[model samples]
Structures are given as structure tokens and as C-alpha cells.
Target chain A: MKSLQELEEIRNKTRESVYLRKDRAGIRVVVGMATCGIAAGARPVLLAFLEEIKKRNIKNVTVTQTGCIGVCRLEPMVEVYLPNQEKVTYVNMTPDKVSKIVSDHIVNGQPVMKYTIGVDGR
Target chain B: MEDLSLHILDIVQNSISAMAETIRIAVMEDDTNDRLTVLVEDNGRGMTEETVKKALDPFYTTRTSRRVGLGLSLLGAAAEFCGGSLIINSQPGKGTSIEVWFPMSNIDRPPLGNMTDTIITLIVCNPDIDFIYEHSTPGGKFVFDTRLVRREVQDIPLGEPDILEWIRSYLSEGLNEIRGGA
Candidate 1:
């Protein structure tokens, strides 16, 4: 029932939003949501970030999506692209982990190494 | 097969891949009652009621690429596992609507994964089709649609080199706002 006009407002206003904020350099969280990723539950991971960013009142951190990372079995995977830091890959992600990642990594400047790729602390 | 939410995303994508012109996705969270709901609708090439029933079978597949179609099967499994249910209804010549209900307390419920990639891939692979994605929490709503984006910028193809990057960010920011950005 939504219209094109709503999307137009978005394209116009936010076209320069992210770029303008680049001077501040926010954290970038990319989650895989390919057919494989979706089948593995990437939606919650994305929402987790949305909730955390708002709850913590954090700025500059943006969450996005990516295609198949070639590891379907370990999906719901999240890659944290921190400002000026190496990309950290986290596997088997869930809504719960999203909070930790937000609080520890984005806000506290400490990545949840235990949840990062290959650790599988599950 | 693993997470319910992921399976839900896959089946929804199947509708998009089937050339749905208008796709609707909704996520609702009720913390007070402790529940979440996801619903996806599409006005695309719909299946016969018979086909709709069979599509849920793990071994039934219309695709020639593989032996089976796991999208719906996984969704069925995820829904059942999470103290929830998935209902798929379709009519020949009409469209399909898939609904997933999850008890937010279900420990096994899969995470709500990335949607940005899902929309982008759908946009890139099916340039001809349009997608309307909407996600709403108790607080607000986020929506992304290709048709609207395409209409606004006539000169630039969203898939084009420079525009693609901006388009991607626009989607992320727009979605973030829908979810009540900070």
C-alpha cells in the first residue's frame, strides 16, 4: 500500500546522509543474506543491530547486507567492519549476539572475539 | 533447515525470483506478549492450489537445477521448531502470501538475518521485476522498493557503477530509519 513517493523522499534525503557522516567514520556491519544466508536466519542479526544502535544511542555505525560468503552452513554470519580496524567475521549469529556485538564492539571498542569467525563458542 | 527466520527469507525470495512485481515483508515484535511475526506477500506468478500444497514437500521441486526444493521445507521445519507456524496460500493466476509466527521466547528460533543483501540481489538479478520490502517493529517501520528508487533517478541506472554504491547506502540508511535510527 506504500507509494513511490515515500521511496523518493528516502532517495533524496539519504543520498548524502551516509557520505556526509563519513567524516565521522561509523562502524559498518555487513550480514550475509543470500538465499543461503536467509535460509540460515540473517534477518534477526540485521534487526539486532537496528535495535542496538537505537538503544545505545550510537552514531556512525551502519548495518548492511552482503551475498553468499561461500559458507552457507555457517550462515547468519556477520562481518563487522570497524572504523580503521580489520574486518571481523562472526559465524552462527543470532539476535542475542547482536546485543553483545553492539555493546562490546561498537560502543566499548572491543570486539566479541569469542563470537568472531572460527571461534564457534556456541 | 537450520534457522526459521532464514528459511522464511528464502521462501520469500523464491516469490521474488518468480517475478513478483510487488513484494511485501512485515516483521512485528510484541515484547509485552513475547512474540514476533513475519509475513511476506507477492503478486507474482502464482501456483495452482495443488502446486502450493506440493511445494511444501521436501522432495518436490519445479526447478531442474537440483533434485529438491528445500526453501519451503526448511520454513516448515523452522516454524514447527519455534513453537510457531507457517501458512502459505496461493491461487492460480493470483499471488502467494507466506506468514510465519514465532514465539519470541523460542530458544531455537533463528535470528532475523540481513535483508539489505536480499533486496540488492533481487534488484540486480531481476532488473525487470520490482521489490517492496517493509519491516516494522513495535516502534516503527522501514521500507525499500526498487520501483520507487528507479523512478526517482531517471538518468542513473541503479546498477551502474557510481550509482550502485549510493543506492546501497540509501537502502541501508532508509531501512535504519524505518527501524527508528539513532
Candidate 2:
């Protein structure tokens, strides 16, 4: 049986630092995870992105899940928000596509144009 | 949802969206009693009475883009189909707790899928929230609380690859040990 005493101790100590880190600007990768998104395989897609980030040792980029992006038709949508840059929405994401996005956009700082909603038009 | 874990994942999203700080998920499997119960309780913004009533209605939803809230409805239907029931308890600003019961021997009852993956994904994706997962069977019980893990890591984020992988194995091994499996 584990205890919470240690958890509370660390939470108190790291609370200030975690709060401070929130203010630091960085890239954000948000995945839509509403019912529609999940049904369309967003779970695996989201997992893939997280796995890729960790595999590549990508830093300063936060990956999170959102309820929905409003385009259920283009589910498994992933949005990338770069600091001081426009938000790019990628639709119909697959794990393979996520890998490409990680390499082309997240790693190399070049948005994968073909995968973007603007170009895919799906 | 294909399995109970997927349903757990889906319903937990509601708690996350409600801004819950602490979420507790409990799974009780009692083969002798032929009952399996899953309880997901969250300390988040609770819903109003009307919202609670409408929650099980597939046509009712708070989202603007879509009109269907199938998460609860589907779970409710599944519970009923399995000779069980689903209950939602909520009070405004207090929090919401959903209790679902299913017959252990019911053929229609969904399998308790890969809970290790579900818990790991939830913790890794929502690092800020504290999760307490309790699995109880006639043999024994296993409880995993992220608050303790947070203390262990202190500065390291829970979402970190090493931490996530460690948590995954911890959960799988812990469950197996409690279930008396090698």
C-alpha cells in the first residue's frame, strides 16, 4: 500500500516551480479527444505523438489533449501552437502522419504543409 | 466503447474538462457475487440537477459543434443491458461521481480492457491532475495514487518517458501481484 505523505510533500515543494514554468512560453501540441475524436482513433494518434516526443527527446514542447476542435468530420485533429506564431491545425491524423509532423514541424521548425487542414481540405 | 477501459478513458475526460483537481477511479470485481462495479469520482465543477438528468440523454450535450453526448448514454445503456445500472451524483460546485454496476457473468458485459494503458495515458496526458485508482477483487486490493509518485519525482514531470514507462509497469505488476498472478 502506497502513501500520500510523500506526494503532498513534493507537491508543496514543486508547486512554485511548476507554476513558474507555466509562464515560460513554448510550443504546445493539442489533440482533440472528444467522443468523435476518440472514435476516430485519436487515442492512438495522441499516444503516438507523446511516444515520438519522448523517443526523440524533444524538449520545450508540451503535448496535451483537448475536448474537441469543432470539426468532428476531420477528427483525430491535432493543433500545433508555436510561440509567437499562428496555430496550425492538422486533420485526419494517423500515427505515421504524427511521426512526420514531429520530425518536419516539431523538430525542424517547418510545418508539414500537405498534412495541414489548409492543404488536405478534408 | 469496445471495453470498460475505453469507457473509463472517455468518462474521465468529462472530469478533466470540468477542471477536476483530483480524480478517483475504482474497479471492483467480485466473481463470487457476480458483480463488477466501476466508480469514477472527481472533485470538479458539479452539474446542475437539470444537467444531471439530461446527461444520460444521447441528444443532450453542452457542446456547440455537436448535439450528442454519447459517453454517459452509451455507458448507461451498457449497464442496463448487463442487468446492472448507472447512477450520477452531483451538486453544483461540489463535484460529480458516476457509479456503474454490471453483472460479472453477463455475456454482454464488456471486458475490463488494458487498464494499465488507460491509467498511464490519463496520467501522462494530464500531468497536473492527481489520480487515485483502486482495484479490488476477492483475493486482494491494489491502489495507485499519483500524488505519491509526484512526491517521488518532485521536479520531474510525470509525463516524462521514463516516468510514464515506469508507471505503466508499476500498475501492471501491482495489479498482477494483487491478483496473485506470476
Among the numbered candidates, top lDDT falls to 2
Highest DockQ scorer: 2
Report the Cα lDDT for residue B62, model 2: 77
lDDT of 2 by residue, B13-70 (tens): 9999899999999999988889999999999999999999999999998778777888
Q: Residue A75 lDDT in model 1?
A: 90
The lDDT per prediction is: 0.69, 0.86
Worst 10 residues of 1 chain B by lDDT: B155-164
TM-score of chain B of 2: 0.97
- Model 1 C-alpha lDDT per residue in residues A84-109, reported as the tens digit of each score: 88898999888887888888888888
Q: Each prediction's interface RMSD? A: 7.9, 4.8
Q: List, in order, the clash count of every candidate structure.
A: 13, 0
Q: What is the CAPRI rating of model 1's predicted complex?
A: incorrect
RMSD per candidate (Å) reads 9.8, 3.6
**Superposed model 1: Cα runs more than 4 Å off:** A1-122, B1-9, B178-182
